[model samples]
Target: MVPLLVILLTLTGAWAGRPVLLPPPHAADLVLPPDQWFTQKLDHNNPGDDRTWQQRYQVNDTFYQPGGPVFLMIGGEGPATAIWVVAGQWIEYAQQYGALCFQLEHRFYGESRPTADMSVENLQYLSSEQALADLASFSAAMTEQYALPEGTKWVAFGGSYPGTLAAWYRLKYPDMVHAAVSTSAPLLAKTDFLEYKQVVKDSIYAKSGEQCYMNVQQAFADAEQLLEHPIGWRSLTSAFQLCAAFDGTSSLDGNNLMQILADRIESVVQYNEDNRAFSGHKDANITIGSVCELMNDESMGVPIERLAALNDLIMTVHEETCVEHRYQSLIDKMTDLDFASENNDATRTWIWQTCTEFGWYQTAEGAEQPFGQHIPLSYYIQQCIDAYGPEYVWIYGGYDQSFVDAAVAATNAKYGGRDLATSRVVLVNGSIDPWHAMGVIVSSDPALPAVYINGTAHCANMYPARAEDSPELVAARQQIGDLIGQWLQED
Candidate 1:
């Protein structure tokens, strides 16, 4: 899955002069509440470890009334922004129910640091189990601190990985959490997430026509063919605007380049037409339609040339100077343990979680996928080994697929995977969201309702209502609101 913060920042760009039918609340208009800190146990599992850390959080009580339900927006792999407490579909629900709202930053992300630096030993404390425990403790503390009315319902709202936590919170602490809205949450823990790419391919084909899919497939094929020769490699370097010349001999370079290209495409497909308010920016017209237009534009030259132009477009939007395809450069960045280094804390922390807990590695190995099969499953496993050390491999037994398989199996065993049986939880997935493949798109029980929005992308329902939103997304949000309301009315 794409990092939640990255998705927010990348997809939600400046309006770029696009007309807005009804503009959503901007950052300047939002009166963000002051940040609050709560002293939390460093290791809830270990009683012997008396270490404590001040976890960052924010609260918005504007619409709160006596005995109203509490809405907790759980933070995921990224920093928790105070804007979430003030602006979001959850905030609208808060207003309707007079609910008190809160957003807690996950430990080791943003300012909620549990250690001095991101050393491998320190990262051991950053597991999903630990995060769930954090939520439990935080909820109890909030109850006592606020002196909430007895049996006042508590609802959890989250998207992406935090959505997974929101659902699991209700499952793990049924008494503490009354209900949860899990949007685009991947319930399963798999090592080789081949389905991720397959969904990407499917989403492109579904959104764009068959011609667009064929064009993308041909682009990758052309890229791979060019990588076969030295002259072609030089041409690719010039065409793609690589920071360094493409190394044809190094499989690492080729793999990195291909993955970068696939990632750019995935980003567009994942958050296509998602509201820009989530990122606190005006919306840019960066949807699947725009991408397909670029891909199928004969005026932009052949498929490979159009592919290069697409990369350049993303680069311009992100303000990136040049694309870096060096494998060691990524290793160097991830290995940086300095807490002060930009993005070091989050990058390393999330990678550690994947290596130990959820192995949601998106690899392009299947033949049906549009992206080339250059990115092997071993490439990701090696990344885990490289980011951490031999200890990671040793802990799991060996340095092979079996090790990753065992890790993934343990996670799914602990949690019920897609078969997670829970009550008062709404599983929301967009038809175009690649992460939906691993999510609970269909529920076997009525208590565990599933809302599958057609022609939507990742976490589409979580954002504030937009005039441009499809009818399906609007209806999905209404269903989710009604479900939460029903849960609150329960004993």
Candidate 2:
């Protein structure tokens, strides 16, 4: 799954300047369902307050039989696309089991507006607690609306953050959902996610050769050395074709540039060999192998020079003129409170959740990682403070690292972190996906199976089957299907 925070950062010029790609068209034979809305509570915790908002949802009952199970496809930090109801591996499962399928857009994302604008006061209503409540309410409402049987079995399916929610939902409300399939879900809430980059480094070494890995490490080292000198800064600016000159003395600017460079490779590695149709890019074939081929090309000069050329190649693919390295530009874009703003709305919402509930900040503080230690945990904390305010940061206690640590701990405590003891919830992770480090890759309980695809990227099994799919991925899907079938039969 393409993380919503990364998408937002890319849009606001904080990360790599990659063009946002929409999901490719669904199967021609499948008919796309129309958007439907249900009234959801603004604050699920308050009983007296009757405030409500319109939550968007879609249903595809093309293969649903009268007494078959119901499949709920939970939306994540991004907008819920209609294509999900028509296509995806879950849709195939629905067809096989004659199950009714539904996709509900998360609050404050897509068209599910809970308030007029994204003011700090309004955003208080948006939380995972409230979202889970929304799901419960949605389930009861759907039952009444569709006249589903009292004991109808419901299976939850989600990927990425939604995947986390899917597992948590079953844990919190077992009666509502009988089974859950969580793909690439980070069960642990961490403040400094250094292991994320570590996994990326390992995946690079595993997919590409040692030379590619060494060159990437060397490139980051060289870039860090250049940032120390003013002349070197100018040279890098010219080579990378930056929109504005970077301040050599400012660590923030240096970190921004370094983070941007890291994001370029991270994105490629995170979605390595994922279906082009799922990624919605014509050149979705960009993989670790392709990136290694570029890095190993000696004609591009030194490692740093090759890195610059790679940046240029990414810009060319996205049709961007120059890389934006100014940190304040990113701040300005994220600080915009207008919900009507094109792309930053979803970013703002997700970032707020990260600050409040989950601190999944991917920092480069790990010693062994290829990326330099420029992007410290403080950079992300500062972003939260700048985007929201000191009040939001101080709400957890203080604006220091301890506050984030405490907040993440609270999140994990509320829901079982990595030691999630839930039944009939299959945890799925791709071995190459960086998020897997935080997920439950091994299960202690036989009922709670964990499927780790050997050579796959994020959400690889969530997408429809392909001829190029790895044998491991194919086997994982079959196992998941068999598990779901067994659960339904038991029900």
Candidate 3:
């Protein structure tokens, strides 16, 4: 059920059919953020795609400052809503910059859920194009129904998966949007499985400092090599997947391993903000978080367990306290480990399978990377590819993704400068982010620029380091933000 709220009136700039620009934080609406209400319901049913969707959006900005820009917030690959934990943050961004923020939830996420039978065919309708079209339609309807005030502009903003949508919106319907800000979003599709994997490895290694990383890598390698001979890698894969799941039970089997894998994935993607400042490093922000989290913590928490809905490969570092979400039926049959190197019959398979399977997975086009997730990029990229040409567009990756650099170069070279309007795709990377490439766009004409930030990880859509670094990083990020603010403030 949609949460009902009383809309705030008496906004500072709502008078005389024009906006009364409030001075930054002093704005009345901002100090007392309006209780933005939403109307969510299915808007269509595509029988061919076997899908139906509900559109949850805010329509009553009647009290909005007369001339403020209409800020539309778009979500990432998964299903999400404006009521998201981040809405207030976005509102702050808008209020700080003097714009009205309206968020749209992607399908199968949050409130914009799909009808029954959310199968592949049904999911197919959740493509980027469909999402954009939905946004366009929603805006048009809202504008007419609400009688949008004069001199209003529209801008889109998002990070990560949602960042991809923002970029796509700018490219697909340049006329509809004034400008967009995409943070830490790789324009390229999911092909960095390998690169992502490696970056996390290195980052974790670095975070632990030289000696710890060295020791751990060696241990992992030693463990990996040892398992290859005496027993099949399958046993190790199961062990890795199981240990990562932390369900620890007497019985461990293939099905249980898969379930554990699914649970791990659920928590990582559930979007835990605490992970960002947790200091203990539990954010689903990177593979290291996943691996680190799974390794550190064991029990399933309320958030990560939901990953089972997406897939069974979502392994993360278990470093937090969590609740149990599984039956643990097979946990009793599992054999225990002895640290002395006995052939871990059950856990070993999980370890071997994950190590082998994830490592073996290639890029969208089969290229390889050392550090990306075989799953996230591919799964998310499919959202765009399934709608646009499989290769009709371009994709870029960061060092954190598996073999992201190579995959990015390939995709960029293939699609870069291929066209003018849509050609000249760029893959931006953060030099410091192991999962990403050097914030450089290689796909567009002459290749896109790789914007760089020293001592920053994962392209930093929000780049917290900006506030904590040398004047150069701060200046650079400020300059970018300034450009965005300028564009936003215009027209």
Candidate 4:
């Protein structure tokens, strides 16, 4: 699955110039009370400096019992609003235990900015460690200010990257966090994340069967060949209806365009159901099953024709109401290849984290990955160089291979990844979630149990209970609630 923050940015229309199709909200519009801002310190380490900024947060006592636990929902690289408090399984759990729901927006995201200027220099303060410090400070102030009963328990909850934060917070502050629910949390930090695409391929194959998978794979091969020849390049561009001009140049642009389309197809499977929150399209009910149907054509056609059908399906699924089919429009829209430009604050912040802390460059190394080797580790490393300047990228938090290697090793050693040793935490993952490759599937110690839900995608069990949900998902969510209940009753 794509990074939680990137998905959220697209949902919030933060792509600036991209004509992305917005998915529906998680549920009915939730009317939250006035938002409150915390005067957070500019730098947590430099407490003596005394410069502060407003950090946005929201609270709901809709189901509060006088002496109940406080549910602190940590936001990812996105805005934290009322939908979190009113429309998720956490809210349902909150109602069950009469817990007070509160969400803390991540620093540098939403209205929680430490500095007005979004220069790379200012974003230095935006790290997971600093974010945890913010949570600790804010939670203390919140408890004291609200006077939420003397011995109220605190539980941490998050999904995806924020899920990693939730689990890490518990590991870091076990005394403060009574329990944590981390769903689809990819704890491992790796430079070459080829496993992500392998999982995507497996998910499609599993859902669509071997024949459909081969057809899709062949379609990618056909497109690759088509980009090599001048005549084929023209035909390929016309077939896909791309807005970008094809000057019959090298296959770099064509490969980039194909990768973008592949990402869209994989994303459809990654967030098939609970996708509304991630995407703003309410009618986006398409899944791998749907795409497979589109790929499997009955009439005999050449490889190029098959490729065209797949591209058409991608556009149909992504933008059913668009006047034209576009993929990272070179002239009018954001190109996937242009991510190196740090013009957008969201992209800049995310890439900085990846370069410095988590080097999760989703690359397709070998033939196993159907997406091709266009978006390799070098592609992302170059992005860091371009965005943060060559000097800074090489010195402080540079994207050098050695620096990234050390960072990933250090992060893995510190966090424990699949071998995470933590207590009072419910680790949940979906079988179809590509990020699940980096998530914990089992634990030798029962204290840190992992739940693997079948036929589910990224954070599938985290959404509000729905009638259409699989029985396994329903049961998995119940198990999480039971675990939290048990933890709350603990000494």
Choose 3 or 4, whichever is better by lDDT.
Answer: 4
* Backbone clashes, candidate 1: 0
Model 1 earns a TM-score of: 0.93
* Model 1 Cα lDDT, one tens digit per residue, 1-491: 11000001000111111101112356677778999999999998999999999999888879887766667766777667776777778778888877777778888877789998888778878888898899889877887798765665556676877778777877887777777787888889988888888988899889888999999999999999998999999988998899999999988889889998987788778777888554544225678899999999999999989999999998888788999998888888888888789746366777677777678888888877899889887887777778877665555555666767787899888889987767877888999988898898887698888899999887788778888889999999899878876776676
Task: Give lDDT tens digits, candidate 3, residues 203-256.
Answer: 555444454334333333343242334353334344353333332232223223
Steric overlap count per candidate: 0, 0, 123, 8
Cα lDDT of model 4 by residue, 1-491, tens digit: 11000001111223211111122254445665668888988888885889888988777879877666667777676556656656667778878877776777788766667886555567688888888888878877887887655555556776778888888887886666666877888888888877888887888887888877787777777777766787886776677776654544634455456656567567766765664543245335677877777677757375457656666665665564322323223222221223233433356666667777888777767567667655566655655665566456545754467877787888888778667667877788988888788888876678888899988888777766667889999999899988887877775
Q: For model 4, what is the C-alpha lDDT against the true structure?
A: 0.67
Cα error, residue 243 of model 2, in Å, equals: 1.2
Clashing pairs in 4: 22-280, 22-281, 23-279, 23-280, 23-281, 24-280, 24-281, 393-398
Best by lDDT: 2
Candidate-wise lDDT, in order? 0.77, 0.78, 0.37, 0.67
**Colliding residue pairs in candidate 2:** none
User: Residue-wise lDDT of candidate 2 within 265-366, one digit each (tens)?
Assistant: 998877788874554464476689988898999999999888988888888888889988988887787777787886464768877888887888888999
All candidates in order of TM-score, best leading: 2, 1, 4, 3
Shift in Å, residue 207, candidate 2: 0.6
TM-score of 3: 0.54
